[model samples]
Target: MKDNGSTKYDLLIERLCETFGALYQGVTIDKNWLCERFGIAERTAYRDLARLAHVLDEVSNGRFKLTANLLPSLHMGHLAEFANFAGVAHLFPHHDGQSLRKRMNNADNIAIHGASSRENQQYGDLMNSLDKAMTDRTEVTCFYRGKSRRLQPYRLINHYGLWYLAAVEQGRLKSFELARIAQFAATQIAFEPDASIIEELDTTSGIRFGKRTDVTLHVSAHAATFVTRRPLFPAQRLLKEHEDGSITIATAISDQNTLFRWLRYWLPDIRIVAPATLSTAFMKDLQARCEPTTSEQPQDA
Candidate 1:
């Protein structure tokens, strides 16, 4: 049978897979051998080898094998491609594959400790549907926070182990926690994705979207060392170092809750310096927490 476009493409995929498997096992292959094995022209064989030239090196006049230095990267590239093909690549955030390979190779010398949000398998179908809608640029109607919302999904973002969907609702960009979304359904309505919204999503550091408020903070000497070691806030910047080892920092926050959470974590060491209203509000909240509620009050004996 004559090879059609689909047949040719399938043949190419099969050839590439076999070639990758051979090279991964340290088996040497030659252009002539590939042509004979695949029953393809010499030019096509050359082109196939050329596609992998970056990771292959000639061992002899006609034999080529995978370059030792690129083996780990090649392995990671293969896995990434397979994951993309399986449509599950979005489950993990993008990372340097070579670095990941190196880390795995030296696993004995490394230990990672961090917290991640709990996973619910029930959301698997929702995620798949959302992925298709985002890819097709289709509108979706989902119940968020017990309210029906119409959204134009843009990107599924994973921030600090939590999953969120960055989408446009009522012409405003917002981040909806994936765990909170319910009654998900793709609408027949198709919408053109806005370039500016996509650009904002790419540029924004965290899940919080839209206009932000600039908040300046004072890091006490007690927390200055840790604060100087790394940024703990969104769009954090070092403004000045005080003579007493304290530091002044500035950060932009689109949500007050986000700032409040950080402030609560670093309490007694970090304080809002510029925005008096926010400081007052945080202080009142702290006081409220410290005070006993009616339910916690001592009852008449």
Candidate 2:
């Protein structure tokens, strides 16, 4: 069941969208119309209408409509960007601005195509709610990975098309994937935002922010060309370029799995130069994946 506070806000947004849509179609609305349609008291309707006074114009006594340039002048680029980032444009009310949304979707060039965008839509709502909690400096309680957690959402990050929240849970900083969150709701408790948390989020990759480990990688000249063309991460630094067409790059890695993925992506051209254990683990994982399983064997019929 939706909470009353959330329901009320959603209803208000719905009514506001309807009113704006009517005004855009040259149909004026009055207080009585809103009250009757939404089954709200006159005073409540007036208050709701007043909330939109900045964009609404009173054409006649108690009758209101949007300004002539309201829709055309409305800037939806930023909101569209958010929708694209969260992949939740479908969750937005269709009656709000169907044509405008269509245009925005078609023109969205920031979201990389072929990235995994078709995740569950509820994740988008979860991400947006977490973002709101962060902005409001409120806490959120949710069941993540079968454990209940109260999180002070500090920073929201979009890394390589995945969304993560850097939060303080149980007095420790951690990163949680938006998709893994279940049963999330904001609490009344508020806390101060930590700058170090935000800085850590900006420097980390994906859900990897904890104790830093200095790791280095050596890439062949052919791969170096590609690596230098695009930074693996903002903190990544080129330590040396060897004459034998190999370059050494270094960065602080927090998650070994993340490094494994990066190495696998540039296999044969990249090798771990430090942290022997991480390199061995990467090689073992690669071999395990490449080795054929018994299930693949052909049985005599």
Candidate 3:
């Protein structure tokens, strides 16, 4: 009793695949049930079952019933893709995409990275802006605040989960933090036949002062707090904590102003333990603050 008279062979294969997949989960694949489902004869149901077993063996070496051991065929990154697709095929709770049909297709073709990158969320946005700026190669005025001063768009950088925009303003290179930016809107003012380029202020590595600095430090041979503390900076490694409780914490800071203040506060708690020069600077500041002033009224002398 068939009416859809296309290819009974194709229908047989599809039903066989489904029946086998369901049976792998302990569901019984009865020939009577198959006849009822696909409106095929009992004889055709038996033939389909044979084909299903053959196909599974050929593809998976008997490992797959419903879902294959994906690692044998796919990257771990692709698991995220599958999850994303499942979430979508279940119907998007919010339709941000243009076409529901296209979304379904996109879900079917997804590839995702299982591991997370440390890049800040703004990194992607900055990259997009940089792409636009690079495409235009123009003077884009991004609203840092107040007056929208114009800037020559440059490059975007991603460093240790931070996003930075390197641009030129009034012929001086400026590095702006994407997080601190109030708004970013590229302006139309542009450059052409630009023979002039600023080199000295070429900001890189998120540094405004674009200079290789020489620093020096000094430490008390007796101060100690890092004996039980973790490495303070990403590059920091625990060199040693001396027997006298003096611990040496090694770190390189992007800026020295904050570190200098912190070292002062950690006074008596810890010391610089290096370079000799910073220790002297701290001592000088401390001595200056402690100096007795000269405003005396005679008492009983």
> Which of the two candidates, 1 or 3, achieves a greater lDDT against the reference?
1
lDDT of 3 by residue, 159-248 (tens): 444566667777666677677666567767667624333443332233443333333223346434443353433345556656765555
- Candidate 2's C-alpha runs over 4 A off are 1-116, 119-125, 284-301
lDDT of 1 at 161: 72
TM-score of each: 0.66, 0.57, 0.38
* Candidate 2 residue-wise lDDT, 1-301, digit = tens: 9999999899888988877766665556788888888898999888878887888788988887777677554444344555666656664454234454675677764453445543556576787787788789999999999899988988877655677778998767887888788788889899987888778776665676678888888889888888898687436899998998889999888777877887888888989888888788888999999988999978999
Model 3: lowest-lDDT 10 consecutive positions: 62-71
lDDT of each: 0.84, 0.77, 0.55
Candidates sorted by lDDT, best first: 1, 2, 3
The parts of candidate 3 lying over 4 Å away from their true place are: 1-75, 78-131, 134-139, 143-174, 179-184, 187-209, 212-229, 234-241, 249-254, 273-277, 283-301
Candidate 3, TM-score vs. the true structure? Answer: 0.38
Best by lDDT: 1
